[model samples]
Target: MYSMRMFLLFCVLCLMSSTGYSQLPGPPGPKGDPVNDGQHGAAGQLGPAGSPGRPRIPGLSGPAGPPGSAIFCGRGVSGQELETLKNSLAKLELVVNYDFVRRVGQKYFVSYKKRESFSRAVEFCSQRGLELALPQNEEENNILSQFFGDVYKTAWINVNTNKAEGNFEADMKNRPLTFTKWGEGQPDKSIQYTGCTMLSENAFWRVTQECFLNAYIICQM
Candidate 1:
């Protein structure tokens, strides 16, 4: 019985030793379930400002190339269309402040209500591709007079008599005033330095020294 008891004790001791040594942690148990996310880190300090970039260089233009294709140069509107426009001046837009334009024969007359000096009137008309109105015949002069006789008593005409005392000339064509429609007592030499002519209320041509006179101007082309 003594020997059997000793053998049983020895077996128990061996079993306990083997279990302790074999445990070891078992490869960490497959990494738990993954921890919660961590907070974000602070931003780093900004770097120093950089130097300005170099300016862009404009490239030199290349040599002139061959001549381009030829293009037709002619009037944009047809004769019929031009006639329609002339007859219907109120429909066409000649310029600002000119609501209606008059068409006599082949000429176009655009009247301006704003007053300006005769020289200024010429300049204004020239800038708009026109010149001061020059009535070619008695009929034209009478028509113009009738149109503005009541509205404006006197307006600047394209005639200038600076060359000679009684020798009047149309500044437009630089031709002598063949058909003179002088008022009852017109062409007085009182004021001949202004170099401008006026169409009196009676449609008569008169010489005035008031070139700086601000009167309505009629431009024609």
Candidate 2:
């Protein structure tokens, strides 16, 4: 019986030792190799476009610009200079159109070959910035007579009685005549219709009722 009990106690002791040894933690295993980074993934698809922004407001206007230069065609020309140019051009045109026949003092006389009525003669001279020939004195009359010579038998003068019977006046300015060389029986007050005057034979002034009588005209400037 004693041997059997001692054998039993030894068996119990061996079992407890085995259990304690199994329960003890063992030394850590060798450290694992560090993990390598994963390869990069492919890029994703692009997203949808965003909506448009609001419209912008307009700004205020700028100030006015500077004045223009007076220089024209590479030359400085003012308003007066332009007027002078126009006058020169008009004089040039007159020279081209009219025949310069005679000149007395500062006045120049020009004539047209075609005959016209007294009214038409006045208009013609007026359009050219001139007036119908009016003899202010005997000297001007003689000059005009010599100018007429044999070229024109009769010519319209600037004297007329259109305002009063036998009361001759300068047609242009309606002023009284300072000089008169009336032919005999001319400007007869009895002949009330004879209003306009003309230059006839010997440079004498004569009145006629025929205002439409076509006669040569002399223009003075």
Candidate 3:
């Protein structure tokens, strides 16, 4: 992981104890006639610099401020608000999908179906009271689509990756996957073992081994 450093912060504060700045009692009435015997201007000695501006009291350090909501990268959100949400999710005992300090929107997401392949991911979500992430807009799509990039084989989405057989068991036998977003001309329909799946951490669907292959699963509330 990489870390970034920011410049030091210099905060100027109002010096509470600093001496007040005032002009020497106005030039004795009217300079000319020596009106009131202009009390011989006591050899005006320059006053000492106002005690270094009261040592720049660092703006009174108030009580530790509460955290803000958490936003992941690219989500575009305020830090304080994001920290608040992160804290709330932390309290609820839900796993934090990603970093909380980023300036991105981080609506909590989960990966409950761990160690399970696409098929099992469906079952995991069903029994666990969660669903796969279903991004609605380009923001969501972009966020969900560009994860781990090409580095991973493929990732799963909220979309169901099953080959619906139309609830049919024709001829007292099983049927092939009627509908699926399989890789073009793929799934080798001739093989009964293939199942619809996705490239790890991705949007498109492909065919891998049977549904029993264990992999990571991502779920959203």
Quick one: best lDDT, which candidate? Answer: 2
Task: Write candidate 2's Cα lDDT for 34-124 as tens digits.
Answer: 9989999999999999998999989998998997747768998898987877876776577567654676776667886558998999999
Worst 10 residues of 3 by lDDT: 5-14
All models: lDDT? 0.72, 0.78, 0.48
Q: Residue 162: error of model 2 in Å? A: 1.1
Error of 2 at 157 (Å): 0.8
Model 1 residue 26 distance off true place after TM-score fit, in angstroms: 96
- What digit string (tens of lDDT, one per residue) describes model 1 on residues 1-221? 99999999898778879787643466655667888899999999999999999999999999999965433255466667766666556434564458446777877777756679888888888887677887888777876775564566777888865645334654646676667777765666565354578887778887777678887788876
Identify the runs in model 3 with alpha carbons over 4 angstroms from their true place.
1-92, 95-107, 126-128, 136-138, 149-151, 158-162, 165-194, 199-202
Expressed as tens digits, the lDDT of each residue in 126-200 for candidate 3 is 675555554444455445444443434455654433334422111112334333343565544554533544444
Runs in model 1 lying further than 4 Å from the true structure: 1-97, 149-151, 190-194
